[model samples]
Target chain A: MNIYQYDKSKEWFQRAVKVIPCGVYGHFSPAPYAPVEAYPFFSDKAEGARFWDVDGNEFIDYMCAYGPMVLGYHHPEVEAAFQKQISISDANTVASPRMVELAEFLCEMIPVADWAFFARNGADVTNMAVMVARAATGRDKIIAIKGGYHGTSPWMQAPGHHGTIADDHDHLFRIPWNDLEALDRILAEHGSQIAAFMASPFHHPIFEDNALPADGYWQQVVDKMHENGSVVIVDDVRAGFRLHMGGSNEHYGFKPDMIAFSKAIANGHALSALVGTDDLKVDAAKVFHTGSFWYCAGSFAAALACLNILKAEDGPARMRMLGEKLTGGLRDLASSHGYTMIVSGEPALPYLRLADDETLMLQQAWCGECTRRGAFFTSHHNWFLSTAHTEDDIEKTLQIADEAFKAVKKQFGS
Target chain B: MIDQLKSRLNLKAVLRNLEVLPALDPVSAELISDWNISLRFSVWRDTQVVLDFHDGRCVFHSDSKESTSVNLFFSSPAHLNNMFENQASPLPLKGFTKLGFLKKEFSQLIGRLEYFLKPAAETVQDEAFKKVNLALSLNTAVFAIPELMKLDPVSRRIAPQFSAGSLQFSVDPDGPHAHIIFDGQSRAVAFPGPAVNPTAMTVFKNSEVAQALVAGTLDSFAAVATADIQLRGMIPLIDHSNVILDRLPLYLQ
Candidate 1:
């Protein structure tokens, strides 16, 4: 399964050093304890089941751009749609045929999305959700969970985190996530003062894969926030499109006041949507919600294609099955090697842990072992399985995992 | 007489002239009641000055500005002098006698003065911030004096344009308060928490002055000043360094 040699990657890395800082934009994704140099080989191109770097090295991609390429990289249909859009007009100026088609598709697909506002990135829609929540309730403070990645915006981080905001703009009020009792205490204490409770249904950096909320966690948060005169904002940016076409929220049988989504909607194209209830969507209109680059047509066409493919005979179901098989194989391999590994979250997105000390060192060791064999990147945070990945890819991954598991057992033997 | 007071001694104009308050040029006399305590000597700014019967109790019912000032009287002129000197303490205006026609008027001024004397803390800290304070109760780790402003050579190299500032910090079990006196100046900016957000942003931004400030490692105001910490804000006021340091620590939390 392995394609390229190690020495070639070193040369490419040397070339990268002359140009970029850290040699990447968002690739410092090693477990905190992992050695800096042993992260993973950089990517150049990817095809069905596998990808390569500038060094011409190949490895099975489980990082999956942290879940955006759910159909895997360069799916033929998705790419074809993008090529058509590019040939037509690049979809920037005149309203592209795909935008209206995509919007109508979303309204028909998701039960809650009556009106849709499109953007280029997850941060854009997430910010719009917060702004609309505030205008609907006419309150300034937002309540969000700890260790959630809503975005890097100052206002969004303000309410959930204290030190995350600037001193000049001190309106943020942070609250702990998941614990209903703590949320109730906060709601009772500051009922009239709060604007909304914005939360990601799944935990990100803390737990691997998907950390499903406790029983009735969503309902309780919504009920309590509403009682306190605050709206609810659901951050489905990563969790959306992975579990279902309507997103994972429908699985829980609860509807949020607003939902923000992006990754995986367009294979690799950049497009995001902020869909909410009728009342909240009205307020979204008043908020200044315009971004120039969001009008890119290539992304919209790709998204429409992705959504159409997602509902086909066996799309999300296939991806989910692949994810389960990969994680299940790793667990079996680890157990066979007498290693007690902790792999949390939904089988749809799995991350591994050798011990309680989930720091950088262990992450580095695990990732280095995988890279040596040919599993490209290890996010310790979340794992993504694309439709492009097949059963043969999973079998090869397990074989690599068996070798890595033995090495880990020997290295960290009790 | 009313025209003379409006032209010569309009309270709002007088406060603006002194620059003791921010400009209220667009606001009208009717809106003075909503002005924050920071705006001093403005028209109808305070309901009326109060004249206490015991030590702190007071009554002034007149709505007219004419009768408000006359009815109020201070316990002693010396007490009034002392009130201005110590800005931290409440002003004293205790004694009052029914001075003929003035009795009804001074009562109104007493009510307005009470409203004017509300603390600045009430205005700057909003309701949301109050909830945060309640949610987080801290037990701080204070740094020792020698560790307060220990400079690092690497920080200086990274921030070559660094200027040394004399920094002081105080550590309580709850949190650290830092004050930096740039170049031996007494005006220090006080930062309330561990140097976190501002320090991290500054380090990321490649500012040597911020690097020096981090190297100073200030925790609170009690620690001694040293030539380790550096500042790069609106400077030249060394004694007011506390204001700068005070705001820096909040970002860390």
Candidate 2:
């Protein structure tokens, strides 16, 4: 067995703790990721579907840098376009033509989107979307799913966190997922006060397995939002480009008034897009949203290139096909080991958990073993399949998973 | 209004709610462990009570006159109402209330208590934060400060050096009232034991600034440089306490 050493990573985490506060912050922090003892606290470098930790160990990455590298990191076309844009200029005093070009491409790609806005991250776009909703509707209340994650702004950080002030989330409503009755109950009371009902394109929680919209659930919510005069904001930052070129809205059979996208937008570039219809165009323009890095034209060029290549190659379909094969292979292997692996969400965005392991210890043990054996997978967070992942890669991953399951069974007595 | 006030001001329940911060918010708890106090809060003819801090837990009393550590005098319903609502902020406490005095004793309670504030659609925005506070007890610091501190990130770092340190505070309007004991064994903060000999002690101009300092919402370093808090011992400890006691707001997913 080739076990990756964490001497360097351990040393780095200790150093990081001294200055970085909890060693590191946010989702990327190693503490929140399970099997923490085995996970690397820092990444040295990454290119195309794989990343090397600070310790120099390599693995076939399925985390995809936590839902960013869609076109298989550092794709030549994307990189070439970005390089060309950078050679001319990135951020300038005046608005770059690339911004308009990217916006035009987005409005064209996403059928329902008539206008687009640029931001540096998903949180910025979502926050801006809320501001735009409030500005447009003249309402203060916004509703989101109970456990689904939006980003970490003051309003969206979970309720009981020590530092959250009373006013921070006073107007935000968290309702149960897939429950129409609960949705109706909240809307009945605060319907007129609500500016928007925001949620992910799908139900993907961090600890729990992902779930698709119950049949008619999405349509009903859309109808209700329309009936109540509340805007629907599909947070497609994670499920965007992966589902369809137009985003999850295209596949889900409904369109949202506002869609915020980032994560995989530019094939791992730090760029986010807020696309909406003409109705919200004036309000979107009225909202104050700007980022120093958001104006960097290089990211815009990369985004355009990534979009072109993905559409031409039909990247979503290929990713789905590869992901489906990987899911079936992993399930068979797990079943062979007398463990049932439940891969939730679509194949492109699979969330793995055990059918029988309620506490997730067994799942953690399996993922720990898999990563140790050279498959960079997350136990709790969802996994992303990309075009960079090949059929051979899937085969190799299945082999590694089989061995990992064996280790899991031996350790956990399953 | 008095009968209505009794139902709205539940100070005892508020203190009990905050007793859990040491286990949950490690940084705020550790900073709190350095102090011990038995301050008395009196609301005219209504309720007079004593609160004892023991091992990260608060012992609440109702209408018992057992020689409290300090005495808070509320002249009228309006005074108690004002104190209960605004909390730590300067109120019209007669002429020259010297709030910096009360703040020095019970300041940390503000920030540490916020970690326990649950989600609600309409939280007490202008004060009476612990909605329960609007119902029963007259003791105000426990509920009011936590509500105010929610805007700032509570400290997440746990410091071991505060374990042996102790600070006693005496605010005017209440004399020799509260004490802070940080005699824990490890980085985890606990209530200080009796017979604590302290390294440093301090008084504030009023409770307004003192609560802010202990909460780590207001920088203790900058507070000292500005002489916002009067000190009695180990200038360096008071100067550098917040370094080990604070972080940006945490939203762990």
Candidate 3:
């Protein structure tokens, strides 16, 4: 198989850097895309489970625009809903009935949601969750898992990230995920001061093996936080609809007081939500969290349509089935090539690494090879599976992955 | 914390570069070739480092302050830091006898270091000179990380999160290389040259890219995106290290 070139992608990136910070910033930034030559810097178009780069290289995308393109890019139902709502009115001086309809839909769908709050991005809702917790409990501190990501808020960023000061994390304490002893100790010591204990449903840190909550971990954590009068918050932004229709917490057999949902919520539309128990409804309203685009009706309509389709079709289960087949095939391929491919986290959002090389150099090369061969794979973050992916896509991806494994073996040896 | 961290960086990272200056610059090497002496810099029981010059080479020692040497004392870390910045002078407790060497020869050596570290735009046009300057700057920046981690509040917090591993930073093919080994704790030791089985590595594509990065002329994120800098292995080590690297300009400038 011939590898792709990115001359046009490079040209666009050269132009981008002059006008945009780092060409593409945030999770889309190429900082994590090593052997960056093997990856495209710009995309020309995207459609169901695939994107064509500016250089005209087509890729079977597993990133799904970092989790938004869930039902698939340009999902018909979601787009039609958005278009119908837009044709009437999207953003206006007053709220649309779609907003109330979406909230009511969420309250009925999610097990823990008594009310729903809207926002523009994952960070907006996550930030509001913290504020609501603080307002309800009148506490100044928060406890979170060390590597779990909520959003890019200063307090949510790791201690040494650029543009963040030491004081920004003063009230936040981090404990290792699933470390019951650490959690117990912190709750025992500073529980009264902590307004909330925030975390994702599972540990999905980058550049490391993703971890699921140990049996009874979340239930025990919820009980302990409640005993300490601290609110339990689940930042399910990344794993929300992909895990369960109600919430990931429902899948894990535990419940959080609030669940922040984004990513797959509106199928690529800019919308996020924080749904909470009735106990915090007043506090949530009192927290005074609002964004300019928070009242946009098109996203609400898109979300309602998207969730309805997902629930009816059992989107999460389908994704899990597809992910299992893909991962299993890739693992067998790696084994055939005399390599060990470690797959972790939930099947729907699987994070894979080559156990043959702990340095991950081989894995990085393999991922780059796969990308250049028309399958977009990243060595760092967990890969997202969508309903759009089919058995054919999985088979083609496995073929590309097998070739990638061969390329890596040829470069680094067995 | 700022003064203490700055002082440690001055003595450990900045002054320590003098040990390699001889190999990079002939004039400075010749000046110290005939000398056989050790200079001890101390900050009132806080911290100390010694520089020994012999056989046209300078070696840095953090262990001993013994033997035939000149002793330079400072009242505090700030005093030492001020001396490094040329805002103050060190009190020669025992270095009075060798004041001429300290004043003239050592000053010239430091002058040469400063010239390379903070080069004139025109001087860097020379490819050979630019390479040496990049090496010196890279060395200083890499070595400063451990020092910063020990005292800087942000770095101290970040240090403990690093998984136990060695991270190597080098230019591709043939160029200066340095490695930092972390024990998965807050402790890190930096050494010049390649590491044995480094868990993580960042390699600049060539001398020109390395120079641009060291001089702060290139955006590292952009460079990485463009494949001018290739990264491999445990990325968190490189990620955390870059945070410390970002602060070098604040102290080194």
DockQ by candidate, in order: 0.01, 0.03, 0.73
Query: What would the per-residue lDDT of candidate 3 be over residues A261-368, giving only the tens digit for each residue?
Result: 999999999999999999999999898878788999999999999999999999999999999999999999999999999999988899999998888888999999
| Local accuracy of candidate 2 as per-residue lDDT tens digits, A114-162 | 9999988999999999999999999999999976778988788754354
Best by lDDT: 3
Two-chain complex of model 3, DockQ on C-alpha atoms against the true structure: 0.73
> What digit string (tens of lDDT, one per residue) describes model 1 on residues B183-204?
3221112222344222110011
TM-score for predicted model 1 compared with the true structure:
0.61
Number of the predicted model whose TM-score against the real structure is largest: 3
lDDT score at residue A139, model 2, on the 0-100 scale: 95
lDDT of 1 at A105: 88
Candidates 2 and 3, the one with greater DockQ: 3
Identify the runs in model 2 with alpha carbons over 4 angstroms from their true place. Answer: B1-253
TM-score to native of every candidate shown: 0.61, 0.65, 0.95
Q: What does candidate 3's lDDT look like per residue over B1-253, in tens digits?
A: 7787888889888888888888888888888889898999988868889999988889898747576479998999999998977899999888587999888988998898888877766764577677778777778888898888888877887888888999999998797888899998888988778899999999999998998876568887678878889888888899999987877767768
Model 2, TM vs. native: 0.65
